[model samples]
Target: MMPCDSNMTSIVQRIARQALLTFRSPPRIGEEASKSFLENHSKLKSLMTEVRAADLHLVPRRASDSPPAVPVPPPVTYMHICETDQFSMGVFLLKSGASIPLHDHPGMHGMLKVMYGKVRISCFDRLQRSPQAAQPGALRRSVLRSTAEYTEDSDPCVLSPDRDNLHQIDAVDGPTAFMDILAPPYDPDDGRDCHYYRLLTDAEEGEHTEQREQKEKEVWLMEISQPPEFWCGGEPYPGPEVSL
Candidate 1:
């Protein structure tokens, strides 16, 4: 049976319930979550750990399969599992050398779990601005929190409304796929819309390690139009159906 209650059988269905229970009433943005909410969040993370590619009926694709006879596929693909007023769940698949450019999740919480192959994620957090900083068009001062690679065996990557809210994801070694969950799904009227960005640097081409590690840990980023080379196509979720 579909996930009409707590009696869900599939891990996917179970994850949907746990996510629903965890995010349905999360504390407001920037506010501290109560103990109960924290506990539920932990459980949700644990459940996510138990998910796998086989569980979702997803198969990894070839590293580079561009046949002239075949329709050229988008660099990335998405398999939407479910969505509600509180959150959205889906899977992202990236082809070899494909990347999802740096983007922001305004006032949202998210979790990403690698299902097949590997992915490298570079995370950033906006920094406090000063009057003298750069009026450098669309640029926002920020700190690069982390740049790490993950595989199916790795635990889910976590993001909060205020921390590590911007990131770029690239498929590593080969094609990659990951399951993603976002709370309070994007709504333009609600002021939660997606934005793309790229790093703004003073140094050109192959500058030096100095740019990456100023010890100042600060960098400038400018918003940009969606990367022309990157586009996401949707696929049907072939796994067990989930419902709340």
Candidate 2:
């Protein structure tokens, strides 16, 4: 069932409050409080019905519905909800087969909750390199931390400053939309900027390589400009106004 829209406190408000509690103090916040905030964030599906197709301009397709000859929807779009000193909250919509490429949010914490359809997320972590081996402007070593698929029924995918900080998101089967929150929002002037990366693997490896070996493999990531293929258009939020 959809949540009632008449509530005095909107979901965005609740999210903002939780974000403040989670990020207000970086050096002094207690572990228990941080865990509690994440737990609350994971259980926030009930608060954000606006991200679903029924609330947006997109129509839900039935199984019998014929596929359109031309899919004119933008490949990707964003709906900016709100932002403060503590966090930024928004929604991203992806057309079928569209993807948000591998990227890193420097010194940021994030949560992603699917409001409709499913997405495959591949996450990675930067590994420390030996000082002697580290070269200026050379590719960095990273490990594939995890790769998983998420649907509306699943809990939000979480990331911190160190863990799962670099990842890619791909829409599966059909159009997908997800609510995203980032703490201490990106500020290029403050050295918190989004950087794009691509994973480098050994091309000589056989295609029949073992899955376990693939997971254990260490890869290098090369920083690059944003791919020309991926760009985000903006759409106005069609939900209740949030004040913060």
Total backbone clashes of candidate 1, pairs 3 or more residues apart or in separate chains = 0
Instruction: Pull out the clashing pairs in model 2.
Output: none
Give one digit per residue, the lDDT tens place, for model 2 in 15-77.
Answer: 656666666654221133366655555445334423454443444433344543545545788
After superposition, which runs of candidate 1 have C-alpha atoms over 4 Å from their true positions? 1-8, 64-71, 129-137, 204-214
Find the candidate with the highest lDDT and give its number. Answer: 1
Q: Where's the lowest-lDDT run of ten residues in candidate 2?
A: 204-213
- Tally clashes: model 2: 0
The model with the greatest TM-score is 1
Give candidate 2's TM-score.
Answer: 0.75
In candidate 2, residue 5 scores what lDDT? 61
Off by more than 4 A, model 2: 1-7, 27-74, 129-137, 204-215
Candidate 1 per-residue C-alpha lDDT over 1-244 given as tens digits, one digit per residue, 9 for 90 to 100: 4554555378998999899999988877679998988998999999899899998998777776552253777888889999999999999989888999999898899999999999999999987533442222476768889999999999999999888999999999989999999998989788787888888666621344354556565777877888889888888889989868
lDDT of each: 0.85, 0.72
